[model samples]
Target: MSTVLAAVGAVHPLAAATVNDNTPWVGPGMMGFLIVVVIGLVTWFLGKSMTKQLRKLDAGRAEQQEAEGEEEAEAAAPAPAHDPKLNGAH
Candidate 1:
């Protein structure tokens, strides 16, 4: 068993040498890098678009809240309910 294992180990380098950079598998390996780069660019663009949309939504909500606050302030602060006999307006 030891002799057979040693023989296989000795032939491993020779077997690996038979395949060069020009092998068919190299093309798909190169395509893997391209696919990663393409996906990264797509994700970056998508994140940018989503961030812009969220910012716009936040600004709209802030404006709506500010307007509603103004209306509530107006309604809650009306003419003072003073004693009519004291003011002589009764």
Candidate 2:
């Protein structure tokens, strides 16, 4: 245990010499903030574009459905019966 203690004591000075208090520590600054803002703006724009496209798609589908309903109603209706009296044929 004494030898282990002596070894640890010898290494402490080397460890203390490697550390410098004068060097500055830097964090995520303006560039990081700009990147995050750009990402948020891109996401917002994409969402708006997707909503516009979905609205257009819904409008087209409604128009198509209306046209199909009209066609079906026309095809289902029967023709009027012929009337000779009304035509003045006796």
For each candidate, the alpha-carbon lDDT, in order, equals 0.81, 0.84
In TM-score terms, candidate 1 sits at: 0.57
Over 4 Å off in model 2, which ranges?
1-24, 82-90
The global Cα lDDT (0 to 1) of model 1 is 0.81
> Which residue pairs in model 1 clash with each other?
none
Per-residue lDDT of candidate 1, residues 34-81 (tens digit) = 999999999999999999999999999999999999999999887777
Q: Candidate 2: lDDT of 68?
A: 100
Q: Each candidate's root-mean-square deviation in Å?
A: 6.5, 7.1
| Predicted structure with the largest lDDT when compared to the true one | 2
TM-score of each: 0.57, 0.63
User: Model 1 off-target regions past 4 Å?
Assistant: 1-27, 80-90
Instruction: Pick out the ten consecutive residues of candidate 2 with the lowest summed lDDT.
Output: 13-22
Candidate 2 lDDT tens digits, 1-90: 556555655889554434523577787899999999999999999999999999999999999999999999999999788999999997
Candidate 2 collision pairs: none
